[model samples]
Target: MEILLNLKNRICSLGIPLHAAFEDIGTDKTVELWSEIFLNCGQIMKEQRLDAGSAWKKVISENRGLLPLEQADWDSINDFGELLGKSDRLNQESVLDMARESIALLEKKAEEAMKTKGKLYRNLGALCGAAVVIVLI
Candidate 1:
């Protein structure tokens, strides 16, 4: 149970966005795969007297930055893929590789966002400074 709980926590922390992304895909096989993984993890957690759902909530709260699509959410998908590849229940290298690729794409997006934010801040500061100088003059 401890093992399953740990596994689930690790997976969630790594930010696979499993629930939503899996739902979006909407394939039986994908759902089955996720269900099996979650079930096995839950069974392990149950043995240890730990509630898997609660554990999931706690993990999310603690590691919110690791979530995908967030400003600080970087490399989470890759990390999740690596975790899945390492897990005994579902060790698929190809899946891990795909996830790594997804992470790279996400990282690129993050970089672009940062650049845009920097430019906007700089422009705002310049405009504010110019307005202040004109008022002082």
Candidate 2:
């Protein structure tokens, strides 16, 4: 149970946009998928006798080629390493809080990106309108 919680916390802290994607898809579907993955992972850990650290290490080693988490997310990967180093000292609430903060930061970044894109579109439209007026003159 500790290993499973650790694994879940680590993954959540990565802030992979899964939760945001889940929100877009609908809460029920999100809950269902979460439950499925949780159960599957729990079973794997039990059957394989894989501790959380070993399981995560195996996943990175085996699926580095296929995992976005393994590539280009160095900061998060580093953060995970730090978390692992201190895992023995941290309480569950602290882990959850870290995950929540990561998710919030990602969501804020996504929103800001969307706002920037919207502003760019508006600027482009204004530029096009100016070009049309200049052509008419």
**Winner by lDDT:** 1
lDDT of 1 by residue, 52-97 (tens): 3443344344455534456345334224422342344244334444
Report lDDT per candidate: 0.48, 0.47
For model 2, residues 10-66, the per-residue Cα lDDT tens digits are 444543232232222233333553444334433444567654344434444543454
Model 2, global lDDT: 0.47
The estimated TM-scores of all candidates read 0.45, 0.46
lDDT of 2 at 101: 67
Quote the positional error of residue 71 for candidate 2 in Å. 7.6
Clashing pairs in 1: 1-44, 1-45
**What shift in Å separates residue 62 of candidate 2 from its native position after superposition?**
10
